[model samples]
Structures are given as C-alpha cells and as structure tokens.
Target: MKKRKILIIGLMVVGALALLTGCIPGDGSHTVAKPAGFFSGIWHGWIAPISLVGGLFNKHLRVYEVNNTGWFYDLGFYAAVISGFGGISLFRNKKSKND
Candidate 1:
C-alpha cells in the first residue's frame, strides 16, 4: 500500500512537470527560418495528452502545428499517436491452459 501511494504521488509529480514543460502546438509563424517537420510531429504527438489538459487552462495552447511539412508531419503524428496508445494492449497477459 505504501508503494502504491508513492507511485501515485510520483506519477502526479511527473504529470505536473510534463504539463509545465511540454511543447505547445502553434502556427509556427514566429519561426520563419524553420517549420515543424516529421520528428517534431512525433514529439508533439507523444506529449499530446499533457497538452490537451494544459490547453484547457491556457487558451494559447493548441494540439496541432499549423506550419509543418504537411503529409510527412501528419504521418509522424498519426504514427506516434497510434503506436503510443496501441502499444499498451500488446502487453496484455494472456490466459494459460493451466490456469
């Protein structure tokens, strides 16, 4: 029970930190020399859950970058999003015949 409590507190702290430091999706208008690309999309997608929660309190935050490499960025974003969530199911414990 103590371990569970510590784990929960640790997770909360990590989550709070992530919310405070995670990237914010935007139009990229401020960066004229470079636009977000595939790798950026992947990173954004990975932290999207935290961003969503942060967005609720901060109106300036967004979920997707407007200025990007188009399809490549979209592909990376979708790939990460799918893999991040889908990978969890892959670890499910299957019933053994003995059980």
Candidate 2:
C-alpha cells in the first residue's frame, strides 16, 4: 500500500511536469494575448495525458483554451510541490524508523 501510494504520488509529479512542459509559445512583449488560432486557446489539454491522447485518437482535438500563457511552469510548480511533500513524508518516515 505504501509503495502504491508512492507510485501514485510520483505519477502525479510526472503528470504535473508533463502539463507544465506542454505549454505553447507565449506572445512577444509587444503582442497581446491573441495569436494564430487564437479563438481556441483554452488549456484544457493540460489536464491529463489520457484526455490529450483520447482527443488525438478521436481526431477531434480540443487543445488549450486560454491564450497568452504557458502551462509548463504551472505544472512544474505543482509537480515540485507534490514531489516535495512525498519526499518530506519519506524523510520523516526514515527519521522515525531510526529513532
């Protein structure tokens, strides 16, 4: 059970990384949030891998929704947070065992 939890935590961290890294290029300093295909800039795709893959399979890709922003940093931040929590838990467990 503990291993499974760790695995799940690790996956969550990885998933967060994936989401953060999947961001599109942001606009230049002079440009507004709008860009090519600007109307469909929502970032729904950054939610999960299965959703992205499923959309690709169906040939009805519904990529991101919000423009002028990348998902990478956001996801990366979340991944770090979760991974840090897991690490803290593991470290505490080890310390407890030693004590």
In order, how many clashes per candidate? Answer: 0, 10
Model 2, span 1-99: residue lDDT tens:
999999999999988766654443221221345432321232332333444554565553323333333455345534544554455676563446557
Best by lDDT: 1
Query: lDDT per residue, candidate 1, 1-99, as tens digits?
Result: 999999999999998776644456762342546777898889778877777877788887777777778899899888888889887788889889999
lDDT to native, each model = 0.77, 0.45
What TM-score number comes out for model 1? 0.67
| TM-score of every candidate | 0.67, 0.27
Give candidate 1's total backbone clashes. 0
Each model's RMSD to truth, in Å?
4.6, 12.0
**Model 2 worst lDDT run, 10 consecutive residues:** 36-45
Error of 1 at 32 (Å): 5.2
Candidate 2 residue runs with Cα over 4 Å from true position: 24-99
